[model samples]
Target chain A: MNEGAPAGAELLEVRGLSKFFGDVAAVERVSLDLARAETLGVVGESGSGKTTLARCILRAIDPDAGSVRFNSANGWTSLHSLKEKELVPLRREMQMIFQDPFSSLNPRMTVQQILEEPLLIHGERKRGKRVAAVREMLSRVQLGADALTRYPHAFSGGQRQRIGIARALMLRPSLVVCDESVSALDVSVQAQIINLLEDLQAELGLTYLFVAHDLAVVRHICDRVLVMHRGRVVETGTVEDVFERPRQDYTRLLLSAIPSPDPDVPLKPLDRATLNL
Target chain B: MTAPVLAIRDLAVEFKTDTGVTPALSGVSFDVPRGQVTAIVGESGSGKSVTANCVMRLVQPPGRITGGSIRFAPDAGDAFDVVKLADRDPRLYDLRGGHISMVFQEPMTALSPVHDIGGQVAEAILCHRDIGKEAARAEAAQMLERVGLDDMERRMGMYPFEFSGGMRQRVVIAMALVCHPEVLICDEPTTALDVTIQAEILTLIRSLQHELGNSVIFITHDLGVVAQIADHVVVMYQGRVLEIGTVRQVLKQPLHPYTRGLLQAIPGVVPPGERLATIASVVGDADIETPHPLVALADGRQVSLPPAQLRRVARS
Candidate 1:
């Protein structure tokens, strides 16, 4: 359930999105919609085209077919048809956070530079205004002003992730796609980041496309979930429905495979009918 | 109680970095019961991996065992202290892979890209046994089949790159078990795999361990994995063993505050709309008060608490 937006307005809508690498259809005929301020989770195994779908939406990788319609401040914009130069301004409306905190951020740049790069690129040339924006974004992510001068190497995995989150939100984007954002962190740190993401979503009315392979993490944060298998969407439903009463056998297998933390509770057996050997 | 197959007592390990000697493990003690899966669980920098390295005597240079003994008892021979054995001692050759083998987290790197599957598996067998190349290859083929690899004959010729993540892991398992070692150390063996593949690997390991009756040292950070597989769990934090008990005792009724913090930190276990309990909320600041005393909770779970804090709680 999306909140804080107009009753029926969709933040993002995808129609028959597809990408192929050689003979492999990395993402095949995928369609999904995201309401404003809603967190739509895309879940699948490593080769399940979840990353391909995210990249296609971000236009980081060009897609072979289909349309990505975003309801921008101006109105609905067709992202798929736009050229590189035309897509430059629209890029400010959408941002992405990568999985590996260690490698994602430019190591040589200070936190201020990393956060301010986007604003500078989007043509905010005033030094004072850029620094102010950077400081404000840092505090929003719960980092102190001192972090502005520190390089990415100085921050811990959790802190680096916070910096990543702050950088993604610095541009004040309508939609932020987090690709396995917290997967690299430890359990405690993961919880901290997840909470931070939720808080930011509520505060800024930001729509999120949270992509991950971990079902439990997706269940914890997502409003609705999309399950992908072998480059195709196998199921899509509310988090409760997808997890509890999965329509697809593949979804059930994925849910069952999650190791239960309680020792007293036995592990769900691998459903052979679902697995199909 | 039956004597543990492997008994580690007051083990201390230190890494001699350029800065100084950093303690990796300090006075850690645990026992791997015969034919049971004993999990060493902890986050990064917690020394679980160091413990596994210690068991296999695979700790690289700059890291050394400072104190304590790792006594391993074989099914038919006298118990020997692993710590006392020299790094290159010929006797260690008989112990390392012959009796104690290891499986790593990433199977891609673990399995050689250049070598054929059968050749690698056969090499593991040949290292510990006085078998001919043909016999070793036959044994490797049989092992591959046991690990659920299809078309063992043709599959044996395949390289590591030819297999999927799950299949590569199976190949690694086949290599580790070819010698039928008494103790198998799996260091986050399934962390790189998908959920379904992970389940299959865990099941395969469990069933193989059952049939082979080997003691297993499973190292992982996920409590969910420890729940499904471990018979006994060792919770380590900053090189110290916080809690050592059955899986039920540790997972359901955790003794140590750190263990409790770890268990509570798992997402999706708690009901919706409620914030997941965090270790930061429990531990507060980084510096913990010293000389902690073990306190028994209402549910009979024992947890170490600072004496002054316990007294303050009592007075309040």
Candidate 2:
């Protein structure tokens, strides 16, 4: 359990994180911090290494270099330095909502089985308690009890994502990395899931590492933004500061690329010549 | 009004399963103007892609075009009903890639992993035109460069896997346009790419459309894309055309409740939570009924709204 790390305290911290696959540096010297309850958007295009950075921080994959510090009820734990057995307890605090709802969830498993697995893994031996927790989480996501028997294949993209969120919350994790969670759903369904995410964050005081390619969704959901380019942080600032008055040309270029829904807002897309960065 | 480059009248398609028949498209109709982008916007099962598939005569087995006429009036060819021709007919063969080529969502599916980029581009040209290998290759290189894939001498020799997603998409665009098709059907062409890359691809398409003067039937669920490039908008819901109008008319003053719901659902269009269920309680029963005949406006725009919906818009 996160044993009272103080209100508004830093939940997670990373410094000079880097990972290399052969000659290519997927994430190079990336540093960031997350407050107790804040949504930080990690914005990038393909090959930008935002996903690799998140994976490294969560210890889903090992980072070649740098450090990670996480605060729990046991106080500050140096996560990068911890061994596998020692890290097991801390693993429950960090969970992930994946990009594809279809592939991320197993088609064979019922919603009850899917949601209850996390609790079972974290040593909730009592079957009734696990089911109750799953039920509670499902309701929080606006899916009722009747969904318990349904398979992932039976549900729509939006409902499947809700199940994914419920699965992520079974352990009541403090940090949930939403990796393009809403992007795959249809426009209307995307809005519903986003609103659900927002509501859950407020209710549970969750810290979010939102990695996405959609600028409009990022702008709406996130409080602060980190712009990544070619495995490096190009800019990190408040959403307004980065969006309205971006410093680097690359950041400006990313901003310029977002297609506005309003037709009257003339498209001044930066030329493909500028994509070399 | 001048005849549109393509007229889709009462388009209907059905997908038959062992259980029963599912009407993928029922009474869908719209007109695509000459040298302009007509965007068909809808959710997943809304039959937007079905409409596009029917146009190219690409709908496969079990999915049959039951009724409708896709009157394709190309720049130089005589107007013909695409539905009347068999899937493998000679006339249909000429129309499929030679005149109306399609760009799919996944470029990898269209492109061959084994073949060199130059070969694929040249193959597209050689299929439709009576040209030699070297001439086709030369034309392919020119087109590859035209779509902004530079260093063609080296890059053209590389396979589709060697290129990035955006680059592969550019090659797909180059292939679709190299044949000099009068009609380009882009079905969610940029849905898989990054926003920056998507923007770039969109710009390239718009610019080339201007240069070639080919009418484009852009099928996308993204209204932002529809707003960005579409001259006309076709809104669909549950396998039918909810409304049809210019981008201005459809987006600014949507005659259908579903269109309004979709537009409002775009992030930042409305407050977060409220936009979630906007479509649920909205869109009355009367508006969704079949037999919706398009009502023309003083402007070039048209809508298939019910009397109540039309009156509501008029008052607003």
Candidate 3:
């Protein structure tokens, strides 16, 4: 480990990450790291194992092999080997934002209930403090305190996403994995959520593992981006470096596929240089 | 002179929720030339999907096309008034998947799980165009083949679950095109798809549009897709037209702030070592109560009044 690295260095690290379902390899040899207060973007097509990587990181599903090392307030711990009970403290330090805001949230629970559940489960604070914390978080996400009474269905896709963010930030986790958090949102609303995430990150010193299929959104928000293909990290670079000087064929193809606003301007023809990486 | 393939004049759509009348679209106007791709691009709730649904007469209850005329110009001198026809009219049914067809987002729900792949496409062909079951099967196979599917015979008998998302979308496209409709409306057809598959589907749509000479209305939030396929572009915002122009004009040199923001947000444009531009502020950027006229930029392109200028009172 680099000695001069920040105290929150390597908030989460994946080494040789691999998962398989029957004959299909869902994720293979995928390695990435999330630094403290840094945003790491994971981009890929469906079946590219971006979600599986997220699951493995969150331990929502156990990986077949590999290690996930997380440096929390309690020091570094390997997440892959930890059982549910052993992982509880670590879970509190890391949270995930799901893709579909409508479906991921419980229909029965009010927004306040949803936000407070994690704090309650961790026994981090008393019920009264939890309510105050929930209200504060809601405010941070630009939601009203009165919204606490309403269920997720009452909110629009973008608003619901804000609630999701509020819930993720409730515990003051070392890292947050936003898995397609804005995919369901409209373009304008997506921008709002992206901006909110950025602001919260700055204010809270929160780190993000922003997973999404939309390269454009990833480009805007992510400090560093990893492009996954068929369950492996195919390309890794800063947003500008990876997008502008894509070193892989799949990356080039993805870049070319983005719907251009200019109908007359065909995608810049791919030269042989882009294929070698 | 030949009539325009699709003409919507002063179109207004509204949905009656418990909250009251929520206007979804108002005075949205445009025309799609035959054999061309006309893209309706916007953020969510921009009424792009609503407009497409209106074309199919598929807007569920609680939503109504309150006003507007939709005229469809078929081949030669043939023309049908779309808005005048009631949803129950046989002509609407005939037009759907016959004269005009649609490919929707989320093929899992769009395709029937109960029916086999072959049965579904065959049913579409047999429904409007009088054809035998065996003949329909052959045509379905051909359609699947045209959509770049291999081993059509075996795949046809399989249910939707067996196919991958991209393949299923292709099947949906095939179903839409099996009858050679005069118009194809794709509502975020590739949104659920992965990037590479999206590329393939986009390529397929572009090629098919060229080969079949069928007009297409592509409704998507993705500006890249509009750039790739659309000749004409229509940008919508909060139930009204924000801007309409050629794809080149709308995308490369976007006049509308929303459009420009969207384009700048794309990851591909960010130079190495630079952070992407994220537009901050409220969800609804446009003036909801009034029709915000798009102004002509210095470059002779159209742009909606920027959110800053339009929201001066709110900002203050």
- Candidate 2, position B53, lDDT: 89
Give the TM-score (vs. native) of candidate 3. Answer: 0.87
TM-score of chain B of each: 0.92, 0.94, 0.89
Per-model CA lDDT versus the true structure: 0.87, 0.87, 0.82
Position A189, candidate 1: lDDT: 85
Give the higher-TM-score candidate: 2 or 3. 2
Residue A221 in model 3: shift from native, Å?
2.4
Native interface contact recovery, model 1:
0.70
Stretch of 10 with least lDDT, candidate 2 chain A: A1-10
User: DockQ order of candidates, best first?
Assistant: 1, 2, 3
Model 3, B1-316: lDDT tens digits are 4567899877888899988999898887888877789999887778998988888787788999899888887775567778889768888888888888999999999899999999999999999887799999999999999998888768989999999999999999999999999999999998888776787788899899899999999998888788888988888877888777787778776655666667776545655334446533221464444566555444444445656673542233
- Which candidate achieves the best TM-score against the true structure? 2
lDDT by residue (A110-201, candidate 3, tens digit) is: 99899999998998667789988998999999999889999988889989899888888899987888999988876657766777888888
